[model samples]
Target chain A: MSNEVQERKARIKDMVVSALEVEPEEVTETAMFVDDLGMDSLGAIDLLAALETGFGVEIDQAELPRLVNIDAVYEVVAEVAGWPLTASA
Target chain B: MNTTTLVRNPVITAWSAVSPFGIGRDAFADGLHAGRATKLALDKELWTGPDAEACLVPGFTAAGVLGKKGTRSMDRATGLAVATVGKMLDDQPRGREIATGDHAALVLGTTTGSAQSMMDFTRDSLTGEKPFFVDPSRFPNTVMNCAAGQCAIWHQLRGPNATVAGGRVAGLHALNYARRLLTSGRADTALCGAVEEYSAARSWLDRVGSGDDARVLGEGCAMVQLECGAEDPGRRALAEVRAVEFGVFTDDCGPALTACVRRALDRAGASAADVWAVSPSGTAGPGEEAALREVLGDLDAYRSPDLSLIGDTAGAASAMQITAVLAMAERDRGAAGRVALITAVDEGVVGCAVLGLA
Candidate 1:
């Protein structure tokens, strides 16, 4: 389960980097996508599409606010995916 | 025939182009001076149709050239237009002044924004699980005004945005429109230009329409900054916009262009004897070149190196022709303070513009 979590997190980070056009270092755990990465609304939509394809989860448009940071993104994605969330997550 | 009076003769203070030669103003000028054919095989991913060789801006990838952030969903024509405008803004000394505030306007010309994007979006809508399940981000590229709109947005230009869809004469149409914008006081600075993006869909269209006369396809964008009453003493004026005349013809553009050149020169207070350089469009009708020769009455003036090496850029042809004129006038010490003539013909529309080089 821990290994699965790590893999999923890495995959999500990669998606963030690709969709937001941010460097790996910029995709910190708590870095806000809007403030730190300059993700516009269109970029957020693109990230949503990438997230759905990456995790095979249907993300509601209403939950877009939860995508502010990397950790929050992982939590929403994990919660929707029925994955076990660790205390740190 | 509409023409801008040479009385106010707005000058082109800066210019740039993204061409098969390469990316900047110098890149294109250098390519022209080198005098080599710019044809190369396109990637199969771009086009699998026949005519393997096309003059594409070498090593161009929207995201690769313009960073991936806002360009992920951007189409090629939009990317080329944005790059051309940005290059002008970054390359020219008056860049900061020209692209400033709501006074700075942009007018881009094209046949139909991005033919590939439109085809792709339509294909996606048809092939997707459902018709309405198409990618939303790709919607903008299907519009004819997309490239112009994107350029305005990317550059934050708040002035009037116009997209001229005049086929081969589109570029000249854009220049004329920019001239009017300045003359009307609607804009203090106008960036007028044209863009063409090579694609498989465009190739198929050419094959369908052009019998055997089709020139090999090429992709590029050329832009010039026109300012009215520029106050900077040191500002570079590559040339002054003298006259832009348009005409419609049934078949032979020879008569139409002859009339256009005559009217343009007359409007600019220039005679055929004053034109020291001529940049004729490669796709010009059979008699068009003869007409220009007859009008100018001198063969040497038309001796400027033919820019056909750049390939037929369709809507961008006239703009590229203008670019070639400017590029030549820049180095030819003999051409200083002289008039250069540029002519273009497409479909039934024929147009000509005379620039008084400075």
Candidate 2:
């Protein structure tokens, strides 16, 4: 379970970094999509879509507001997928 | 230079439009007369729905015209361009009856030219190195200038042909270019306007990805026949382009647009008070509205926001706007109107034209 969580998180990070044209090292948990990565409204939508498709998780339009930073997005994906996620993992 | 001076006044002899609001000239005319809007249903499923409803061309096909072989090679944008020009020629007597040897030029404008083709090719190339079938013919159609080239080939317009891309200002630029060519004695007549075909692939991308942003799925072409001057005195000349001014307004468009309008009016030997009607860029924004009000003067200057029905056609928007003014020239004749100033501002570019009706 821990391994799965780590893998999924890593994949999401990779997708976000590539889609936003930012360095992988720059994608920290505290990184805000707009301020840190220079993601505009269009870029944010694209990033959200990528995260959903890459992780095979569904994100509701209403829940979009909860997805602010990298940590919140990961949490949402994990919660929706019924996976156990830990801070260490 | 003496060569740069305009020998003759360029006139829009004939014009045609194909859009979701209307399929042909008659349909477009009826729609315009009735004040009909062409906004479509935005379906999230197709990306033609809710978030962004665009004006799309209705019942478009390239069957009898291009044939199967030719159709297979061209993308949707090329298909629309070829089809629209065919209809324009067939409908307008002046456009169709022109002699084959007549030195007519072609200028086309577009933004997302061949993006659909590039997407398709990329998707296909992903499958295998030794692909099952790679159509080499589609490659040439993927070029940005393919629509202009194809139009030239179809019409046998062997003289100077060019294509321009300037986001929303493309059509105005093409018209201005045609005006320059005719004035400079490069060609007697030219087919100038914009062509764009919304691809299914583009829609698919938008549906799955492009969120919250407003973009309509639309495809069509609008073209006009421009000649040096009226061929016959009896013919009711729609409008004569007296002067055209272009300005790059990167920041505040108000002052620059005002200056350009002043320059255009000055060149046309007219003043703001002489101008009765104003056709704006009409992008459904406040900045342009403020600029128009400030530059043209008077809150009620016969403004037409027809672009709302046609969508932001980029290049076609300007030509279509001018066409509207020309269409009204016949009606405004009784009032003894001297000129109509058409203004188009896009991104950081401003295009203003003063037209004389006879």
Candidate 3:
């Protein structure tokens, strides 16, 4: 993966952690927003808005539900921001 | 009109409070007895002007007690109400049983929903790159009934949920509304309370709007559990709500308060001299006090420690004051069997409630 992609991923991770008020270690790639991070539907919407504001991307409402984990969020945000998604990063 | 004739006399089963003094009744009573001011300088980030004071609940974290899921979207006012109701239920042995049932209701009083959230959301919509980029989750918090509705949702209270908005007298209005619900059989148990949240907007408004710099702004929530009829076995009644009266006046609140107190006492079959303690709103100016004195006649009347310690809580003031009176009665053995009167006069409205030891 390129340094820019890694940096963008890191920034998105930080935004997710900050929005959820969770620890960095807790926001693992596999951690589910609802099951692990304790976010409800409303909180999920808040996370979407925060991500949009943070990344300067317009996320479709339908894509919100798919943003369940850190990996999923990174992929969707990366695609929307036109960042190349490497096989492993 | 004679309001005393329509008395139901509901019993106050359990109560709880969150104020600048602390979270519970004991903390409030201790602060009241200490008689020291609890007002503190507002955070510089919250207000832009010179140092102003406010009575904010010390060390309150909603996540500490209510966890984080349902609380993420909750504003300060809603958090206060949820916390107060949670504490009230925790104090009662059968509280869970009562709360889970469909017969339970929640009524909260507030000046408005959350001025802070409303302002923030609107500002975001207007200034953001896009017109609708604001967070949709915050929209619910902007409604006037959000606090009460959130409380019901958080506690599983499925009965009628309502919110009464007004000035300081909102507390009395909420209590009286709960009393009617219980008497009319619309609800068997009512979780009634008042809540106010301190925000830079509210502080600025209070500062510029009232022109009364001496009156410090405060925020907190006070809740009481009201049950219809007499107390059930194993449940102790803190005080019996005998009667409640409220009315508006154009200019002079003295006559209106006097009349309201007269009607409440008459409904309770008690006189002004029978009132052991009187809790008046902090906004009750000299004229209102003089009117109350004229009606109740130099009784053991006092304002809640919250008024001097925390500042005027606005909508929550009357409920906090009533909770203070109940706490006083519970702490002092001599206060038992003595009737207590709680009055809130604000925005040309006078509200009064009569209570006696059960």
Candidate 4:
């Protein structure tokens, strides 16, 4: 991944932390939104809105279920914002 | 035949309070004895137009008392109820044992749920970018029984859970309900109380509504543990609930209040002279006071209208007043075996409870 994608990923993590009121260290790339991070359906919507506002990107409603973890969230944002993905993915 | 009969009264095993006096029963007692006003200026963000004051529980963070988990979405009313219940349970010798049992019940009283959350959720649904994008977590706080329901869930109480809404008499209603449950052998032990939280919507409503001019708004929760018994030797009994009576009036509260007190005293088999203290509802003005004076007639009792200091806590007012009476009984050895009368006048209803200190 490019440095810009890494920076964006970091920013997205921060947004999740703020939205969920969780510690930065507690939120990991593999942490499940609902199971591990304690984000209920409402919290998930709150996170989606926060991410959209912070990144200035519009996420499709159909993509909501795809946002299961931090990595999945990053992928959706990357796809929507047209960020370049690594060939290894 | 006279209806008065000899019967075992429910004992108040433990009690706790969260008021502007601060968190616990001791703080509440100290604040009352200190005789200083507990009212503080309402937050500018909450009250944008006029400078209003309320008795808000200071530095109360539910996360601090109850931990961070399962509290992020809790409103102030629910938080106060939970925190007060937690404190009451802590005072019990086998609090954990009682809470984990299936026979322990919870009955909480509130004028309503968090008005702020209700308004905010409704406003969000109307003005949000998408019509259906309202926050889902706040939906639970909008319910009238949210506080009682949350208390049961958080404490793992699996028994009967009920929420009573009786405006200013909510505390008496909760206590009366719990007493009935205990008497009927439906529950082994019960936690009963009332809670009120200060909010922008509530403050605005009070200003516009037909509330008493003398009483200011306040917020807090007061809870007591009740069990079917005549004072147990092993347990610390604060007071014995002899009887509870309530009645509705069309115009004059004076006669209604007098009748309620007379009924309570009669059921308790006690006379007006037996009462050591009287904690009438803070909202009770000249008419109610005159009724109390007429019924009791020059009775030497400590008349502590806590509303003058802590303000009117709405649904929680009666519970807080009873708590004050209990504190006085606990502190004063002279008050032992002396009855205490707590009266609540709200809307068109008058409720009275006679408690005898053990």
| Best candidate, DockQ | 3
Residue B36 local lDDT, model 1: 67
Fnat for model 2 comes to: 0.00
User: How would you encode candidate 4's per-residue C-alpha lDDT over B104-182 as one tens digit per residue?
Assistant: 8999888877888788889977986665565566678999999999998888777889999998899999999999888
Best by TM-score: 3
Residue A5 lDDT (model 3): 74
DockQ of each: 0.31, 0.01, 0.43, 0.30
Relative to the real complex, the DockQ score for model 3 comes to 0.43
Best by lDDT: 1
lDDT of 1 by residue, A1-89 (tens): 38887788889889888778788998887898999999999778878877876666788999998899877888899889998876677
Worst 10 residues of 4 chain B by lDDT: B1-10
In model 2, the runs with Cα more than 4 Å from the true position are: A1-89, B1-6, B42-52, B64-69, B99-102, B128-133, B200-219, B303-305, B331-336
Q: How far is candidate 1 from the true structure (C-alpha RMSD, Å)?
A: 3.2
TM-score of 3: 0.91
DockQ of 4: 0.30
Give the C-alpha miss distance for residue B202 in model 2, angstroms.
5.1
How high is the CA lDDT of each candidate model? 0.85, 0.69, 0.81, 0.82
Candidate 3: tens digits of C-alpha lDDT, residues B184-292: 8899899898999888878777778788778777889998999876446767788988888997899988899888999999988888657678888857679777888
Q: What does the lDDT read for residue B22 in candidate 4?
A: 91
lDDT of 3 at B37: 78
